[model samples]
Target: MGSSTGTARHSFRRRFTIVVALVAAVAVACLLPRWWCGRDADQWYRGDPATVRGLAEEMVAFEDDDDRWRAGGGADRVVGMWGLLAHQMTALGLAQVSLEHPEWRDRYAPVVTRAAVKSLLPQLRSEFTSSWHGRDGLAELDSPDGHAYLSYPALALGMARLVDPAFPPHLAAQHDALIRAFERRLLASPTGLLDTFPGEAYPTDVAAVAAAIAVHGRATGTDHTAVIAHWAQQVRAVQIDRDTGLVIQRMGGDGRAHDAPRASGTGLAAYFAGFADRALAEELAAGLFDQQRNLLGFSAIDEYGDGHSGAGDMDSGPLILGISMSATGFALAPARAFGHREKFTRLYRTTDLFGLPLRSGDRTRFATGGVIGNALLLAFLTSGPELAR
Candidate 1:
C-alpha cells in the first residue's frame, strides 16, 4: 500500500510540473510580443523626430484616400464621426509636427492643408449630423443654437493657417469667421458652456471651442484674451466636478452635470485646453493622473475617479475591469504634454501591446488600428505645445 501511494504521488507531481511549464510558456508567448513591440515606447514621448515622421507619413498616406472610409456594419453616424475625427486629428498632428520641427514644415504643410479642407467637406458633416441630429451640422453655423462640434474643424483650420500663413485666402476667412462666431456665442452665454447638440452640452466640446478661438488668435494675431480668460473662469466656477476636480463629462446648457466626471472627457479636454490655457490643461491633467492605475508596468486611466463607478458607453468605449479604452487612449496626449514620462511609457507599452504595430520600410501602422485609430494615435503621440514658441 505504501509503494502504491508513492507511485501515485510521483504521477501527480509529473502532471503538475507539465501544467506549470505549459502555463509559463503561454505567459511568455503572450508577453514576448508586448515587450518586443514596446521596446522603443519611450522614443515617442521623447520626441524622436524620425519616429514622429514615420507615423505622420503613414497618416498622410491613409488620409490621401477618402474612399478608404466606408460605412460598414456600424451605424453611419458612428462611421462619419470617426471619419471626421480622423481628418481633424491628422491635421492637428501634422500641424503640431510642423510647429515643433520647422525642418519638416515644407513637407507637411500641404498634407495639413488637405486634412483641414477634408474635415470641412459638406458630405462628411451631413453623414454625421443627419444621423445624429436629423439635420446637417455645418448648416447655419452662424446660429447660436449649438453647433459646438464645429469647433474641431475650426481648430484644424486654425492649425493649418499657423503652419502655412499662406493658407488660401478664402479658407483663412472661414477660420476668422468661426473664431468670431465662437467668441460671440461664448461671451453671450450665461453659463459659459455651449450645447454640442440641442440640449446636450459637453464641457469637452466647449473646451475645444475655447482652443479653436485661442489658436485662431495665435494664427492671426487676434486678441481673444478676454474671451479665453472669461471662459476659463466660468469653467472653474461651474463646470468642474467638486469631488474629482475633473471637468464634468456632460453638462446641461446651464452647466449642471448630466453625467459623471470621466477620464475620457477630462483627458481630451486637457489636450484641447493645452493649446489655449496651460494652467487649465495642467489642472485637468493632475486630476486625470490621480485616477491612473498601474499593474505589472502597464498603466491605464480609469473611466471614473475614486468614489465613482459606471458602465462603459459610447464615449468611454469598452471597460475592462473599469479601465476605459478611450480614456486610456486619450490620456496619452496629456500624459506626454504634461511630462509624465513614466506614465506615458507604461501607457504606451500598453498601447503597443494591444495596437499590434506592423512596420514596413520607413512606415509603421498599428494592425488593429484602422485609419481613425492610427490618426488619433499620431495626434496623441505628437501632442505638445502648439507652435512651441
Candidate 2:
C-alpha cells in the first residue's frame, strides 16, 4: 500500500511539472511579441507595425478607469464627460483592434460594443437630445469655451456606424445636429477661427474648429471638405510657428499666438492635417516626433527639464514630468497616416513595451490618467485607418 501511494505521488508530481512548463511557454508566447515590437521611447520618435499593434493594446487597456458603473449606481448610470469620452474611444479602438487582429476579435467585439453604449449611446439618446430641459430651447448644449465638445461624440457616432451598421439612427442624427452646432459656433467667421464660448472668441479656436469640422466631415460624409479647407487655412494661419514649423496652442481673439507650441494642439492638428494636407501635417507633426531618444515630450520648446510642470487638463492628460504619452499617442497615429514614416515607426515601437495598466482575463486596459479622455485616445488610435492605414 505504501509503495502504491509513492507511485501515485510521483505521477502527480510529473503532471504538475508538465502543466507548469506549458503555462510558462504560453506566457512567453503571449508577451514576447510585445517586447519584440517595442518602440524607441525617446525624443523625436517614430512608429512601426509591431509597435503600433502594441500601442493599440496600450490604448485598448487605457479604458479601465471608466469601469465606474457600479460606483455610479448601475445600468442607467453615467460617468461624467471625460469618463464618457474614454469609454466611447475605448469601444471604438477595440472594434478597430478587432478588425486588425482578427485573432482577438471575438474577445473584444462585445466588450467594445458595451463600452460604447456605456460611453456615448445613453448620452446621445437621453441627455443631449432636443428634449433635454432648460425650459424648451433657452439653453442648449452649447460649446464649452468655444471648443466643440460635440466633435468627439459626433466622431464616436460616425465610428459606431463604421463598426456596426445596425447602430441606431438617432445617434447619427444627434451627430449631425452636433456638427451643425459646431458650424454655427465656429464657421460663422470667414476665417473659421472658432470662439470657445458662443460670444467669446479666440484665434486658437481656428484649430479647434478645423478639428471639429474635419471630424464631422469624416464621420457623417457631409462633404465638409471645403469647410474643412477653409478652417485648415485658418488653423495654419493661427497655430503654425514659423520658427520651428511646430503648431502652437491657444491663440488670443486678437490673433496673437500663445506662449509656445503644445503637444496637445500639435497632436490634435496632425489628425486633420493628415487627411487634408499631408505635407504640412508632416512638417508640423515632425516637430513632435523624437526618434533617437525614444521620447515624445509634451512641448516643442520650453518644456525641457523642470521648465513646464503640471497635469490634468482637457487636452494634456497627466503629464509625467512633461512626457505626455497620451499626447504622444494622439500625435503618433496622424503622423503615421501623414507619411512621417520614420517618426511613426519610432513612436510605434518605443511606446509598445510600457504603459499598459491592467489585464482582466484576455481583456486589457491602459487607464493611465483621465477616466474618459484615455478611452477616446484609445478609440482614436484603434479605429479607422490610424492602425490599418
Candidate 3:
C-alpha cells in the first residue's frame, strides 16, 4: 500500500511539473514576439499619414463591402456594440489620417459621410438592444444608454469638413439633426453626465460623446461651452476618481460611483478628453499610467489595480492574475496622447504580439482583432493633438 501511494504521488508530481512548464513556455512565446515587435515594428509602423492611411484602406476593405459593414455581435454582449462602432470609428480615424494625405481623400472620406448621411443608428440601436438588453430591446433613444453611438457620425462629419471643403449641404443638415438628437439624449440624463445604459453610466461614454460634440462644433463653428462646463462639473463632483483623477468606470443613476477605478474605462475617457479638455486629460493620463500598468514581461494594465480581482467581463477582457487584455490594448490611446512614449510603446508592443498582423500586398491589419482591434489601433496610432486641433 505504501509503495502504491508513493507511485501515485510521483505521477501527480510529474503532471503538475508538465503543466507549469507549459505555462512558462506559453508566456515566453507570447513575450518573445512582443520583444521582437517592440524592437522592430518600425519596419511596418510609422507616424506618417500615408503609412497610416495604408492601414485604413486595408481596414476599409476588410470591414466594408457594398457600402455596408458586417453585423457586430456574438456570445459576448459588449463586443456587439463596441464591435459595431469600431467600423465607424475606423472610418473616422481613416479620415483623420487623410488630413495629411490628400491623395487618399477619395478612399475613406465619402465612405464615412455616406454612413452618417444614411442611417446606421437604427440598426445599431436594434442590435444593441437585442444583444445587450435582450429581446425587449430599448424602446426610445433617450431611454437607452447609448448616445455615444452618435459619435462616429459626428466625427465623420467633422472629418468630411476638414478633408472635403465642399462638404455636402444636405449632409450638413443631417449633422445638425444628429446634434439635436445628441442634445436631447444629453438633456434626458438625470445626472449631468450621459448614461451608457438605463440608470447606469460610465464616464468614458460621456467623454466620448463630449468629444463628438466638440468635433461637431469645430466642423460647424458652433459653440457648446456652457453645456460642456456643466457636464465637466457634474463629472468632477460624482465620477472623477479621487485618488487618480481619472474618470471612474461605473456609476449609478443617482450619480454615485459604483466600481473602483479601472484602466479599460479610464484610459478611453482620457483619450477622448483631449478634445473636450486637454489639461485635465493630461492629468488623467499620467495618473492612469502610474496607477494601472505593471512593467514586468511587458507593460500591461490591471482590471482593477487597486486590490481587486474578478472574472473577465466585456470591458476588461480575459483577466489573468489581475492583468486585463482589453485594458492593455485600449490603454494605448491615452498613453500616446499623454506623451508616455515608453509606456505607449510597451502597450503597442503587447498589442503587436497578440494582435496577429496580416498583410496583403501593400496593406496590413491584425486579423485576430477583426475591425474592433484595427479600429482601436487606428485610433491609438492616429491619436494626438491633431484630432482636437
Candidate 4:
C-alpha cells in the first residue's frame, strides 16, 4: 500500500509539471507578438517619414479600389456610415500630410480629391437617411432644422480644398454652401446646439460643424469668428461636465445632457475643436488626460470618468476591463496634437499590439483593421497642431 501511494504522488507531480510548462509556452507565444509589434512605438508617435509614407501608399491603394467602401461588413446603413467616415478621415489625413510635406502634395492630391468626393455621394446620404428613420440630413440645407451631421463631408471637402487649390468648382461650391448653411443655422439657434437628426443632438457632431466652418474660413479667408465664439461659450456653460471637465456625450435640442460625460466623445471633440478654438481644445484634452490608464508600459483611456460606469455602445467599441477601444484610439489624436509624446508612445503600443500591422515593401496596413480602421489610424497618428497651421 505504501508503494502504491508513492506511485500516485509521482503521477500527480508529473501532471503538475506538464501543466506549468504549457502555461509558460502560451504566455511566451502571446507576449512575443506584442513585444515585436511595440518596438516601433516611438517612431510612430514621432511620425517617421518612412512609416507615414508607407501607410499613405496603402491608403492611396485603398482609395483606388471602388469596392473598398463595402468592406466594412454590416447592414447597408452601417456600411455607408463607415464608408463615409473612412473616406473623410482618409482625405483629412492625406490633406494634412500634403500641407506638412509640400513635396508630396502632387502625389496625394488626386487620392484626397477622390476621397472627399466619395464622402458626399448620394448612396452614403441615403444610408444615413435610412438609419435616421427618414430624416434626410442632406436635404433642407438652408433651413435651421438640424442635419448638423452633414458637416463631416463638408470638413473633408474643406481639407481637400486646402491641399488642392484647384479643387473641382462644383465641389468647391458645395463646400461653401455647407459652410454658409451651418453658419446660418448656428447663429439662428437659441441654444447653440443643433440636432444631428430629429430630436437627437450630439455635442461631438456640433463640434465637427464648428470645425468645418473654421476650416472653411482657413481655406477661403471667410470670417466665422462670431459664430464659432457663440458655440464655444454655449458649450462651456452647459455641455461641459463640471466633475470631470469632459464634454457631455449627448444633449437634447434644448442643451441638456442626454448621456454622461465620456472619453470617446470628449477625445474626438477635442480633436475637432482644435481647428476652431485652441483654448477649448486644450481644456477638453486636459479632462481626457485625467482618465488615462497605464499598465505594464501600455496605455488606454477609460470610457467613463470616476464615479461613472456603463456598458460599451456602438461608439465606445468595446470595454475590456474598463478600457475603451474607441476612447483609447481617439485619445491618440489629442495626445499627438498636444505634445504628450510619452503618453502617445504608450497608447500606440496598445494600438500596435491589437492592430496586428503587417508591413511590406514601402507599404504597411493593419491586418485586423480593414479600410475604415486603417484610415482612422492614419488620421489619428498623423494629427498635430501643425495641421491647423
Whose lDDT is greatest here?
4
TM-scores vs. true structure, each candidate: 0.87, 0.62, 0.78, 0.87
| Candidate 1 global CA lDDT score | 0.82
Better of 1 and 3 by TM-score: 1
- lDDT: worst 10-residue window of model 4: 69-78
The residue pairs in collision within model 4 are none
Each prediction's RMSD to truth = 4.8, 12.1, 8.7, 5.5
Model 2, span 104-194: residue lDDT tens: 6655665565565555544433333332331212135363334443454444454455455465677566656766766665555554555
Instruction: Flag the better candidate by TM-score, 3 or 4.
Output: 4
Q: For residues 1-389, could you state the per-residue lDDT of candidate 4 as single tens digits?
A: 99999999999999999999999998887777557757887777777788789888898888866645456653333356787898898998888778767889999987898889888876776755876677665666767776877888999999888888669998888788888989998888777788886777888889989989999998899999999999999889888899998888888989877889999999889888988898898898899989899876688899898788888997888899878878888888888888888888778888988888899898899887788888988888888787432
Error of 4 at 218 (Å): 0.8
Local accuracy of candidate 3 as per-residue lDDT tens digits, 330-356: 677776655666777777777777787
lDDT, residue 10, model 3: 100
The clash count for each model shown is 0, 46, 1, 0
Computed on alpha carbons, the lDDT of every model, listed in order, comes to 0.82, 0.51, 0.66, 0.83
